[model samples]
Target: MAHCQFRLVNGPPQRYIADGVAWVLDPAVGGGGALRNLGIHGVDAALSLATGKLGLKSVSIANRIHPGPVEDHALLVLEDEAGALFIVEAGYTFASMRPGGDFEWRIVSANATLIDHGDHVICATLDDAAIVDLPVELPATRYRLFMRDTLDRLARKAPPPVSIEDYVAAMSLIDAAYQKAGP
Candidate 1:
């Protein structure tokens, strides 16, 4: 069971927990936090990213009001002086730096879909599919460490390193592994 907990330092204090850490979809409560701000625009984009189709009929947070389908969605939140921070409580499988931690593990999924969120951008996709069937026993800490490493690596470069071919290759392996492992 991949376990993950998300906490926003500056924004409203909101937390969410999930399994597997891929597609981080933890329920949200009313607040100004990242999850809450995942308003209609963001939600629509997420749905599109997940299903790979546009024209989302409607979207609601906890079954609220859904006006209509949206054209685009982006789930990123950038602060004035905070640089760039991607609010990814969904569609991810990794943890990040902590107050006290020496060693780290990298377990980030390579798959992702880009979404243009007007001002910023958001990527929504499954974590690397490799761990699909590894086992529920895998520690959540592993995912946290993976996320930490991914973000740290991102911070070190002017333009992050990404290869669609590599991502596709990794995802294919994950798919094959899952097919063989699943019943």
Candidate 2:
């Protein structure tokens, strides 16, 4: 792929409450915000599609709306050895009522560009403006599916779908971004 972009934005006013506490606003409790909570998925997705070694290009993090120890928004830019660019953006900044928030995933390659619209994907050829809609089957609740798969694997004595190495690699990137952003 020449370029890949993912955006996970929410409109919940940057505060996550559970039992009368906003634990997500606490850096120590939540580890970090936006990037750590939401952008990690994007990082994992990018890593899955990487052709070669990838390196961090830049990072921008902020808590413009809700000033706290944790950031409410983050943006990261990465580049692979093949010169492909990957951008991941996460934020609690949109204005919507949806609990899951708004999600966008787009991939641009030499032959075509694919834009994910939740239930369908639009593939447009680089040579022509023609587009094709590809239907996809998605679960209404991804968390439920994930939990079911995890439990099934455990029952079958199978290894976890996501390995510790994968988690480490993704977290290392996020740590680097935080370090680059500085205190």
Q: What's the lDDT for all of these models? A: 0.28, 0.83
- lDDT of candidate 2 vs native? 0.83
Candidate achieving the largest lDDT:
2
TM-scores, all models, native as reference: 0.22, 0.87
Please give the lDDT score for candidate 1: 0.28
lDDT per residue (tens digit) for residues 93-183 in model 1: 1133332111111111246343332223344457552322222212345458667777987788534343455344433432332234232
lDDT by residue for model 2 over 1-183, one digit each (tens)?
899998888765444673355776677987788899889988988887887767999999988876777787899999988899999999877777466577888999998998875556789996887899987544246677889999999999999878989889889999999999998
Instruction: Looking at model 2, report the run of 10 residues with the lowest lDDT sum.
Output: 12-21
